[model samples]
Target: MHSAIPHLIELQRVDHLIVAVRTEIETFPKRVREADAKLSGARTAVAAARERLVNSQKDRKKFELDVQQWKDRAKKYRDQSGAVKTNEAYKALQHEIANAEAEVAKAEDAQLEVMMASEEAERRVRHAEANLKEDETAVTKERKVIETLQAEKKQQLDSLLAERERALAPIPEDLRELYTRIAKRHHGAGLAEARDGQCRGCGMRVLPHTLQELRRDPNEEIYRCESCGLILYTLEPVPVPGSASGSERAASSAVNHS
Candidate 1:
């Protein structure tokens, strides 16, 4: 056990380092995802504004065409009025001309309304387009930053993984497998320190004899906790204020019958 103690300590250090690396790598993509959502929303707004502008322009064009058609009809009626022979025919021509003029006036008013609406629509489209351009620029910058961060994180992770491989190289195959299995079950914390008569990982009290054996072994080999089956190590035990010593603590507790 004494011969394997250094290897166990090395393994613990490697696991801690890798855990830190994994955490940092996970955060890189979250930043880019947030930026992408913002960019997509901006694009949608721009598309809606452009659609409104197109409809407004179509309306304006139709109204202008109607006004021109009514003006032409009014001219025809005016010419007919001068050539009319009968009084009734002349009166009818005059009435037709008045009706054509009214139509032209109404058409003109419609055209004006459409033109005003078109102008407003165009203004909104331009504003949206500008906003979209700004968002695109921001997205580009954010993507570049994300790429840079990913590259940096990859390099760091590679280095840490290499160190982990080195640390595990000297450990026995069976021990390494046991450690890995425990790590998987315990969310990466395979080993726990027994301090103050307590297993740090699961908060279970360690027996006096178990603590004695752990302290006696100079080479710390892998040892499982009796209660939680977690790997345990003995460092300098921290004395709990007003708590009993190892022998006294053991004597006070009910023995495990099992």
Candidate 2:
């Protein structure tokens, strides 16, 4: 009975490793996907900024073409006015020239507006591009970190699995079943310590008679915490608050009551 508790404790330790590694392995992909999503958003910003710059340039080009076409029309009208003989014809041609000049002015104003906006558009594209590059680098670094972590966890998983099998070798079938069921119910933590007449798992005060029985058959008897249903193991002579021996305190803290 004295040896059984150590075996169970050892089994629990191995199980903990297995559970932790498995959790990390499962969540790693989701973390990577989230990072990828951020990268995609940054890239979209760069593309949108570039598109704006291209559209602005296209608008400027169209305006310039319009200005040139109106200017040529005005010149042709002015030349035709020279060839006109009647005052009515001359006045009509002058009016046409004025209208053509106004069209040219409108086109020029539009061109100027596009030209003014082009600088800002280009600046935005550059800024977005820089941000994209930075985000890409960050994504790459995060991917590498994930990969390294996954590899390490994979190695650890294999080792833990082997250790778990070994840990199971000494336990009987009934205890194993109990351990498995309880562990599943308690997030892979099947056992808890009873200390200072209290169940550490659920903070329930253990009865004096039960505590005495637990001390008598600490390893042989299967003592369970009534409140939490965790298999209980006792550590006698609870450490004092300010005692020189801090080992028990440290052990208690590390115990996975949760």
Candidate 3:
């Protein structure tokens, strides 16, 4: 039972280490995915801007073609004006040519406006593309950093897990289960030292009888905090052999009871 005190301490340390490792592993990937999402949004914006630029350029070209067709029609009417024999007919043809010319001028102006707008849109597309590229580059670098960190964490966690498994191997199965349950309920601290007749975990005063029982043998039985359900170790000011503090004595007394 005395020998089991060290095993209990080792088991508690293992639980804490495993908890830390699991937390880091779980959160690192989320951060990486968030960075990826940002890059995707930037790329989508660039693509939308580029599509608008293309549509604007197409509209400009269609307007220019319409203007050219109207100009051709006006030139044809002008060339045929001499063939008209009646003065009324000649004046009517000239009026038609003037109207066609006006239409052509309006179309040309519309085409110019469209071209200017397309140029502006093209510039916007270029700017968006640049921003997207920059974001993608940043994402790539951040992902690499995340990967490196994850790898390092994984390596350390694996080593710790191995050590923890070894440390837990000697603990009796029932006691091990009890420790795990308490750890899960108490946020990784299954073992708490009894310090100056108070539970270190919750600062609750220990009953005099319980303190006397705890001081007998550290490894007799598993002693738990009445208030918090944590395994209790007595912290005595005096140092004992094979014990770091007086708490080991309390822990050893409990083991003896167990």
Candidate 4:
């Protein structure tokens, strides 16, 4: 019957929603970050693939230069063979030319290997780039959605705050302060319903005297559960036929006449 009880209950309900909304708002950033991380990983993969392609191209270029140098060496040895007067010198020059040609062939073979690897690297780069773009687009879209949701939640929070202020208006300032403190300590539910002489918040039994006082007191003094420090409230109990305060008990207690 306390004037502040209904307002406190409304305040608790609004606070509960506020806490949930705030918790959801907090997770939005983490969720967006997770999406960004995925996009970043895709970008890294593309970069690695491009680096491999570049290295493979460089290797191919080195091999091509090696082949050109070996071909030039063979050409020089062939020209020197014409100037050689001794048969031994001429044969030696031909042998040198053969070695140079072998070197050129070896270089070409390595160049071909590098070309193949470069092609594979290029393919991977293209695939990774495509994946990166897709991931980036997806993340961007997701972020927009998350941002919209966050804005809506912020608006909702503002409305709830205004509603909470309205709820507090009907409550006495001191009682409102006490309720707010307790609600903060107990996750936005400072009051507990008492049913069948039990504190629902802490599952503790209320004392008989306390229960009687709660039911019979006209002053509307607030009661709190000793175990959990939560304000306790009770609904009016229904009268029974045979129990205490019932018609049957009253009749049995009445003095009988002869």
Against the unseen true structure, what C-alpha lDDT does each candidate score? 0.83, 0.87, 0.84, 0.87
Off-target runs (Cα >4 Å) in candidate 4 are 212-218, 237-258
User: Tens digit of lDDT per residue, candidate 2, span 1-258?
Assistant: 245677788999998888888998999999899989998888889899999999999999999999999999999999998899999999999999999999999999999999989989999999999998999999999999999999999999999999998989998888889988998999888888888789888899988877777677434678788999988887685345667568666778789564
- The C-alpha local distance difference test score for the whole of candidate 1 amounts to 0.83
- For candidate 1, write residues 1-258 as lDDT tens digits: 345556767887878888887898898789889989898888899899999999999999998999999999999999778888999999898898899899999999999999999999999989999999999998999899888988988898898788888888988888788888988888787778888889998999998877777777464555689887878877764455566676676766746532
Candidate 1 vs candidate 2, TM-score winner: 1
Provide TM-scores for the models.
Answer: 0.85, 0.77, 0.85, 0.88
**Which candidate would rank higher by TM-score, 2 or 3?**
3
lDDT of each residue in 1-258, candidate 3, tens digit only: 235557778878876877888899899979999989998888888989999999998999899898999999999999999799999999999999999999999999999999999999999999999999899889999999999999998998899888988888888888788888888888888788887889999999888777666666544776778899888866454335666666677888999999
Worst 10 residues of 3 by lDDT: 235-244
Backbone clash total for model 3 is 24
Best by TM-score: 4
Ranked candidates, highest TM-score first: 4, 1, 3, 2
Model 4 per-residue lDDT tens digits across residues 16-119: 89999999999998988897988878988998999999999999999999999999999999999989999999999999999999999999999999999999
Off by over 4 Å in 2: 205-221, 237-258
| Model 4: colliding residue pairs | none
lDDT of 2: 0.87
